[model samples]
Each structure stands twice: as structure tokens, then as C-alpha cells.
Target: MDLQSDLPPLCVTCGVCCTDAFFRYSCVTPEESARIHSLGFPVEREDGREIFSHPCTRLCGASCTVYEQRPATCREFRCTTLSALEEGAIDRPEADRRVSLLRAAVQAVRQLLPKEEKIWALRARLYADPAAAPQTRLALLSMDILADRYFKLKGRRFFS
Candidate 1:
């Protein structure tokens, strides 16, 4: 049996953890690195470790295209929401509602920023200069707060 089959179904509908919203990169072993590279994904070496940036290229919407061959980090990491669901602490509908809210917030932030811009870069630009226009600053702040709430709800930490 596939171990992933036992995981909460919400994982297939939530891509927050894969979008660089929670983690900047996913770490991989040398073998996994080679596999990802062979699959045409861009991999980076940092501190002697292989890593892939978030908004992972293999992510197709809310699911991973390389699910069967995903890196260990991806396979092992579980958000609080998923844990809760697995333990029957929250029902599927509740999990879906939470994921939907997070997805809407993410979409709102994407709409507010340039289509090609990375979220971390936009966040840094907003943080580096407080002199940005009030509206822009407000939008960034709102996005930050929403992101924080999403992370908190997922039982994860917002690294920013």
C-alpha cells in the first residue's frame, strides 16, 4: 500500500507548503538531487546540500507531479492541519474550508503583485523601504497578516 494514501486528503488540495509561502526551499539528498535534475528541475547547492526553490516546478496546481518520486523532505513534512485530520481532530469539510480560505488569500496576494514577481522579493521590497506608497504598503501588510494566519492555522511557523 502507498503510505501517502493514509495521509489526510487535504494535502492534495493545499499547496501552501509548496509555494515558498512557508519554506523557501526543499532540501534533497544527492541521489534525489540527481533525480530531480534528471527530471529537468532546477536544483541549487547550498552549504553542501542540494535544494529546490519553492513554487516547486513539479507542483501541478495543488498536487506534486512527481509524487511517487518526491524528495524525502517533501514526503516527510506534514503540516498541523494534516496531522489534525489524520488524527480525526478535524473533519474533511473543516480541512477543506481552511484550505480554501488560505487559497483565496494567496490568490489575493498574487493579484496584487506583478505576475512575474516572486513573493519573497515583493515582501523584501516592501520591508526594505517603508516609504512605499500607503496603498502598496497596506496591501503588503495585509498579505503578511493573511499569510501569518494561514500558517498559524496550519500549525506551522511563518518564517518571515
Candidate 2:
């Protein structure tokens, strides 16, 4: 049921990462700095502080406007590459719990995210393989512990 291991790559071309959907995007290095500028965007400014926002205006029709000159954040923000996303370590019961926890966390972060059927599909996949990823399996176990503790502390079930 480990979804990450069995599911093929899902390119979320919907631009969720580009907008203020979950987290803000920023660049620090000179190369990244250059990349942002190359996109024909002005440096993000807030209350006298330079800050970047997500969902760059450069996105056009479900794609990056400046693909080659995109910022380093866009380049490195490939979460699908995470070991958790890989097939090997994603089939344990803990892995199932981790996927469930991730789904809860993601839904808590953005209800719209769960509306995407991809979430349900991935949730079903967390137990697809049992012997592939031990470390991820352990991390998933820890995430389950944290998720349970979080629910107890908050007094509300995120998924329920």
C-alpha cells in the first residue's frame, strides 16, 4: 500500500507550490538570485523587507513562464524525489500510518489538497510494499507517534 513506491511520478503541474498554498518561496544564493530576476519579476517586497511569495506570476497556463531561468527553489523543491516518495521503503504498516499522517497534515494545511484524488491514491499505496525502506519505515513510525500525540494535544482529529 506504500503509494510512493508503486505510484508513478505525479507531476503536479497545477502550480500549488508556486502559490501561497502551503509555504513561501525564497532565494538566497547569487545563482538563485539571478534566476528569479531572469523571470521578469520584481524582487518581492514587504514592509521594507525583501520577501518572495509563492505562485510566481511567471506561471502561465499551468506551466512556468521562464522554465530555463527558474529559481533554485523551483529546481530543488522536487518533493517527489524524497526517499519517502521512492518505492523501496514505503510498504510497512508504519509507512501506511505515515502516508495517513501526511494526508492529515496536508489536509490540515489545505483542504483543497485532499480534494485532489491523487491523495487518496497515494494513501492507498503506503502499504504496497513491506520490506523496501526500513529508515523511511522508522521515520513513518515516528511520524505516527507524533501525529497521535498531536491529535491528543489538539483534541481534534485532523482526518475525522
Candidate 3:
């Protein structure tokens, strides 16, 4: 998803990200590619080297063929907040505040990026720095807390 800070509100029940086999999915590492190829899936050449398509044939409609054995990247990607925001489940003012905090945090981080990372990724470093202001730290914590429940991988989505 390019992992942009301002990515669109989560796909909701739109199921769009799952459809067309996630056209942008590309979790190809040499080892993983070799594993998929061993399963008899087509592995085509791109730029004279083989490229593995993500969201493979096993992705049946909105369902996964192997949810339990899905690759590491897919398992780790948690689009919780986006999904909640899109489903109209997040408390509006809180979501707005969290988003504002995120935007401000990203702006601050960009000045120091390539060294710093996503505000979500750099939460610890920023929060731990004594130099960070109290209000800023509080805002970061709010963002973190909001981020926590926005996506629940273990339960059904809370859509309204």
C-alpha cells in the first residue's frame, strides 16, 4: 500500500483491497518466490528475471486460500485504524484528533527522515526522548491508543 501516512480510510466492507487479487501486492522475496513456484503457480519473467505475483490464484474472491500459512508480510500488516474509520466506527472527534496528531508528527518526522521513520514506527524513540514536549508526547500516546483498537485481526469488523 506504499505505507503512506495519509493513506485512504480503510477499505471498510468494500472488499476492494481483496478484489482483483490486490493488484499492488508484491511480497516477493527470492525464498518465498521459490516456495510459491514449487506449488505449481505461474512464475513469469519481468526484466529478464522471474517476478511472483502477489494475491495469487489461491485468493478466492474476498477469501484467502491459505490464511493460516500466509506469508510474513501479510500477517504483519494491520490496517486497523483505516478500517475502523472507513466503517464509521471510530469516534469522530477522536479520530480527527488522532489524524491531526499523526499529520503533525509526520511533518516533524519528515524533517529528520531517512534516519527517522513512520511516526508509528518511531513512536518509541520520539516518546522516549526527554526533549519531546509534554503535549506532543500526550498526542503521540493518543495516536498510539487509537491505533491499537482500530484494527482487530481476531474479531469480526465493527461496521455500522
- Highest TM-score: which candidate? 1
The C-alpha RMSD of each candidate to the native structure, in angstroms, is 4.1, 14.1, 12.9
Model 3 lDDT at residue 40: 57
List residue ranges in candidate 1 displaced over 4 A. Answer: 1-8, 133-160
Name the lDDT of candidate 1.
0.71
**Candidate number with the higher TM-score (1 or 2):** 1
Candidate 1, residues 1-160, lDDT tens digits: the string is 6554566456667877788555678887776767778877788888888888878898889987777777888787766666776787877777777788777767666676777876677677777888865665676567567556434545555542
Q: Candidate 2: which stretches are off by over 4 Å? A: 1-12, 45-50, 80-160
lDDT values of the candidates?
Answer: 0.71, 0.46, 0.46
Give the Cα RMSD of candidate 1. 4.1
Looking at model 2, residue 11 earns an lDDT score of: 24
Question: Model 1 Cα displacement at 136 (Å)?
Answer: 4.6
Cα TM-score per model? 0.79, 0.39, 0.34
Candidate 2, TM-score vs. the true structure? 0.39
lDDT of 2 by residue, 1-160 (tens): 5445464232233343454433444553554666566557667655654446554667664467666666665666543223343445443444445444554554443333334333323333445877745554454455445545422223433221
